[model samples]
Target: MKFTRRLFLGLAALLLGVGATMAHAANALDTIKQRKKILVAVDIGGPPYGMIDEQARQVGSDVEAARLLAQDLGVTLQIVPVSGPNRVPFLLSRKADVVMASFSITEDRKKVIDFSEPYGVVPVVIGGPASAKVASFADLSGKTIAVTRGTTSDQELTRGSKGIPSVSIVRYEDDATTNTAVATGQQDYIAAPPSTILAVKKASPSRDIASKFAMKAYPYGIGVRKNEPELKAWLDGWVKTNLKNGKLDEIYKRYFGMSLPPEVLQ
Candidate 1:
């Protein structure tokens, strides 16, 4: 009886030790350490966020941010091209470690993934031909507006101008299509972030109809899996530190041609 009891106690102690070690090893940060690589999802179609450069290298604000984050984490950064609609699904499926796409935070999105603290703010604007008379958001009523289907600009126009009768929304699969639609006069106006619209206009100066509407500011954030609190905290700290140290401002100017607005710089 005594021998049996001693053996049972020994086995219980061994299991308890193993359980404690497993619990510690299962920590989010530790899991990342074990993997030694962070897979970042970036949109290949979105410029100024994530897109392929002439050299076929991924280049954009999100891509740069991921590279910096991975460097800070002492892990290799793996870029995964993801579409706007597949962002959350890819993260939830463990196909990516983080999403550095220019994702706007929304209540509906919060249900599936967690967003890092806001690192950038983009204003939705209505752009038309320079000769076109679109001075304000209300002016778009009864007009054909082009926008990317799954973007915040679309959501904003849908919610902000729902009361304006005759405002027809034309959805495009990507920004390039939306720009083409507006440039060709197939769409009367294009609703998008000022930075992106401005870039498009610069790329095609002949697209005489280019303007932006004044709307609420849309903050952009990095995304991670819902339960990855440690990673979230790390990313938030990384952004805060970079912003305070002026690195973030430099990045903003490199991509957007100017420093971030004071509100966003903070």
Candidate 2:
């Protein structure tokens, strides 16, 4: 009888310990409320998504979206500028509460982190000087393509160019550097989103860059750390409200000069 009683007592203690662990687990929403700020990671390297304005201040679609999130949550917004490759790592390392870095939603990324419903869409494309004849993936043979590491463009180019042994894929750390390669003539072709290609043209007007072909368009979402149901749910609802109210589209049009994809709006 005493042994059974001790066993029961041990089980009860374990249950209490488990309960405590669960209670102490981090809930990002509550933490944000407690701290009165939401740290959002953004990549200013990419323009129209995130970039610097004439006043040297951060301004772009992603930047405005982050502000909206903080405004609606009643928290101060702290933008943590990051490179494209480090967006997920920053969130996982707790350096940022969320990632608003034009983060493309992908099956591979969803395996590690959680994403809110898509708020915007960006089309990936292969762009080069107007003189380059690269209308299709097959035409990439014997040409070099620059891409930002860890981006969908990089992945698509790498995968699609495997059959073309002569195609050389050069990877840069961020969109800014990738675009620079094209502007300076260090590389003739770039795999990036259309907005980034447009920024490249705007920066180097003499270069006469143009999109050669369109790849798949990807929907982007707010990235939250896994297991933060409260934060994820709140973000989902916030996205829905803003998307429905046309605020998200408004921000997109301001930067992209076009409406959000019809599918994303639905």
Per TM-score, the best of the predicted structures is 2
* Candidate 2 deviant stretches above 4 angstroms: 1-18, 21-24
lDDT per residue, candidate 2, 54-101, as tens digits? 899999999999999999999999999998899999999999999998
**Candidate 2 displacement at residue 29 in angstroms:** 1.0
Q: For all candidates, what are the clash counts?
A: 9, 0
Worst 10 residues of 1 by lDDT: 207-216
lDDT of 1 by residue, 1-266 (tens): 99999999999999999999977865666677789988889887777887788899989888888888889889999999887667888988879877888888888788888888878777777777788677766777778888888778888888878788788998987777776776666876778877667666766777765655576677778887877777788888888888888887787789888887787677
The local distance difference test score of model 1 is 0.80
Residue 8 displacement (Å), model 1: 11
lDDT of each: 0.80, 0.91
